[model samples]
Target: MRITPKVSKAKAEPPLILAIDIGTSVVRTMVFDRLGRAIEGLESRRSHKIETRAQGTSEANPDLLLRLVWDCIDQTVAEG
Candidate 1:
């Protein structure tokens, strides 16, 4: 998977925060300002699938999730 970050030229005023969300099938990364507002064009996202067994068991690969998180963070920072 490749991360295509949204590029923003305007710098975020100080006190920036990085937010990461790992959902059932998607991982997201965003940069927010002190006021809790997302910085424009500073976000990344990746989608993944979970394994579902016939016995009603759900499984997710930890290593894959970790890699997604890393990629999101790296892309967000690189864009910011």
Candidate 2:
């Protein structure tokens, strides 16, 4: 006599939660389901760095940072 093994499959659903982190040097994004399990993620580094020359000096390019943020978001969304 021969016996067959049974297999089970789980249902699939769309992701529920999305997390994004935008830092001065790096940007990262992640997607998670209702259970908080990560499904997709992406990270990218800034092309340019913001530096201060003096104790009171401060500088940053908002346009560049915005571009990097969009790039990271696009990549992460594409991975999904």
Candidate 3:
């Protein structure tokens, strides 16, 4: 987050950008500035497992994946 100085000592804040990454085994969320630079303190991550079968097939539960993504988003926003 970036703050600008003003005559009255009040700070002008910049617009925030949130980024979410859902990978094969992990979900991650982070906050970034307009320039796409990540903010240092706003981030969340969670790992999930996929169901694998003996036939070399693997699957993930859609509901569980969605919930994990939402949880990451919520946690990251709370930090900001």
Candidate 4:
């Protein structure tokens, strides 16, 4: 004969407010509760492949960066 332990699911919490900061080097997303207390967060570094060659150079793949931002936000939301 074998005995098995029962598992219980945790109660879901209220939705949190999300904040994001995107820069040339990295992207970050944070989640806060109604009271402005941080609940969860995520960060992702920009791809090194995207770069500039000459002086006053600034290069970026808008589509790729946008996708990264979305991914970071999604991760933070899921954690919260």
lDDT ranking from best to worst?
1, 3, 4, 2
TM-score of each: 0.84, 0.59, 0.77, 0.60
Q: Tell me which of candidates 1 and 2 scores higher on lDDT.
A: 1
Worst 10 residues of 1 by lDDT: 3-12
For candidate 3, the lDDT comes to 0.75
Please report the candidate that would top lDDT against the real structure.
1
How much lDDT does each candidate structure score?
0.84, 0.57, 0.75, 0.58
The candidate, 2 or 3, that scores higher on TM-score is 3
Q: Which regions of candidate 2 are displaced past 4 Å?
A: 1-15, 40-48
* Model 4: how far residue 67 lies from native, Å: 0.7
TM-score of model number 3: 0.77
For residues 1-80, write the lDDT of model 2, one tens digit per residue.
54322221132134455567666666666555655555533333345577787787867688877787778778766755
Tens digit per residue, CA lDDT, model 3, 10-78: 221356667788888998987766555567767899999899999999999889989998999999878
Worst 10 residues of 4 by lDDT: 4-13
In candidate 2, position 1 carries an lDDT of 54
